[model samples]
Target: MTASPLLRSYDDGRLSLPNRIVMAPMTRGRADDVSAVPHPLTREYYAQRAGAGLIVTEGLWADPLGKGGPGIPGLVTDAHVAGWREVTDAVHAAGGRIFAQLWHVGRMTHPVTLPDGELPLAPSPVRIEHQQIFTKDGWLDHVTPRAMTTAEAEATIAAFAAEARNAVRAGFDGVEVHGANGYLVQQFLAENTNRRTDRFGGSLTRRLRFAVEVVEAVVAEVGAERVGLRISPDNPENEIAEEDAQGTYRTLVDTLAPLGLAYLHIIERGAYPALADLRPRWPGTLIANFNGPQPTTREAGEKVLNAGLADLFSYGRLFIANPDLPTRFAADAPLNPIRENLIYGGDAEGYTDYPALTPTPVG
Candidate 1:
């Protein structure tokens, strides 16, 4: 694969990338809640993928009340910091730069996942339809959420900012706000989900306030160059809307334009057109996740890079399969297949078992 000049090192603001491939943050519930720490397996997991130019860790909960599932990790305590430090140290030692992805489930929660069986809060009191969330016992469907008052919204932003401070202390190089996939922040961004008549909802600019505030607050805690925002403009998972997709995201992207964030990650699916328009609309780095369940092939990634559709491309399953994904792409080597089952729960069976390719002996 030929390296496009566009794929060369990226350095403008405080952001820097030696290559154009980033390992997208993936959730593998391998943390121990008793200690609330990242397991040794988690350390090995990141170390294996150190070849990617950049790695984004699975979403780390900002507060226990915001946790969505069992076995998820958090950045609220000292133990959590130490555990994450191990993961970051391992990544750095193996020549990788990593960022912690901050998350809050918002209404995508159940009583079982909360600290004391409290109902999760949302912009409105509406219950999500046909959505399942992980609990300490098992999977439970989402419940009707209580609407947050002005005070609650202010508290939520402070929580996110606190987590940003913790992320840097945890030794992560940066942080990505998990404002996608219909989670807490994205829930506010979608008008259909956000029915509040207050300043947080009602209008496009109002609906976009939560997401922008999260980014702005986190950037204030950290630096704009160390912050990235992820969005899935049209995905309806968790009963989110695809309506007004263009208007919603244009407001978001343009609002964030002046912040000069490290990158804007848009998961490709129902928002390709909107994402394409963002290339010129956004002055900072833009990362486009390739379409499809299967990982983007080297050819496809190269096409995206050469065309300048994105400043970088983020890969999920491919990074799982090829720990040395950057080298594999560089050498045009065949990739190992990843087991889908191990993609979520379980131990290291398929998690850290994938091996890098070694050259065959000449006969």
Candidate 2:
């Protein structure tokens, strides 16, 4: 049988991937509750999935206030560096490359999730409607986040740059800016959440200013070769409302075209056709995460790759259960089911306990 196009070797100068399958980043809250350091089991979890061409780590908060949940890891302190260094070392030792997805949840966070009892900050004092936030206590109502001051906005940009440097120091192959899924960066892009008239809001260009600046700062710190940006393009996730997603994101891509970053990751579903609009605009390596069923089949992935829409396909829940996902795809093997209950804030049961494919004896 011929090899699947999804498993093709791709080398675009910067990222020399063994295959085109990317293990998409998912926020599995498996860190120390207080310090927000990655659990020791996290290393084993990633190491076991070394078969993936690339692994984008779960969103690691860039600062203490950036944390949006109970057990997500951070990249702020020396302890964070130490903890992540262990994961990076384990991945590299097993011949796998990984990128840290730098995240700051902005208004997506609650006071309980934050270190201090202070309100979460965002582009404006707008509360995300029709959504609930999960924290240490339990699911709680969303609150109107405090508007970030101009000085605070600038500090946030600097914080992202600092986190990029820290990620490199921890021996990460690269860093992915979490500009998607209604985080701090996306909050600045969406109209409903960003009701400010400051330089970071209002006009289309101004509303895009914060996200551009965040990417620019990170690129400046760690060279564009080691940076990637992820965007949801009007995705209503986290109750974000982007009325002009196509215009905003098209301009965003055109504006950042000269940076020559590693790649642009777009989260797409039925609501909007991402590749149809954004693919022609992006000339570099483009990764398209087609949010379909839990276990994204190889047939579905190859169809997109064969259609020439994306350079790589990212899988989330599929990788959770199938550690050797690429191998499974290669062998056309059956996959284990996911333990939905143990998906978050748990020990290695639902994590590193998933078995890899056992090698069959040669006749």
Cα deviation of 57 in candidate 2 (Å)?
A: 0.2
Q: Report clash pairs, candidate 2.
A: none
Which of the numbered candidates is closest to the native, going by highest TM-score?
2
Cα lDDT computed for each candidate against the true fold: 0.83, 0.91
Clashes of 2: 0
Shift in Å, residue 335, candidate 2: 1.3
Model number with the top lDDT: 2
Candidate 2 TM-score, true structure as reference: 0.98
lDDT of 2 by residue, 1-363 (tens): 348997788999889998999999988898998988999899999999888999999999988889998899999899999999999999999999999999999999999888668899998998877878998889899888999999999999999999999999999999999999889999999999888888998899999999999999999999999999999986877888889788888999999988999999988863768787888988899998877556677777798889999999999999999999988888888888899998998898899999988999899
In each prediction, how many residue pairs overlap at the backbone (N, C-alpha, C within less than 3 A)?
0, 0
Worst 10 residues of 2 by lDDT: 290-299
TM-score of each: 0.94, 0.98
- Candidate 1 backbone collisions, by pair: none
Cα lDDT of model 1 by residue, 320-353, tens digit: 8788888777676788988887776678888888
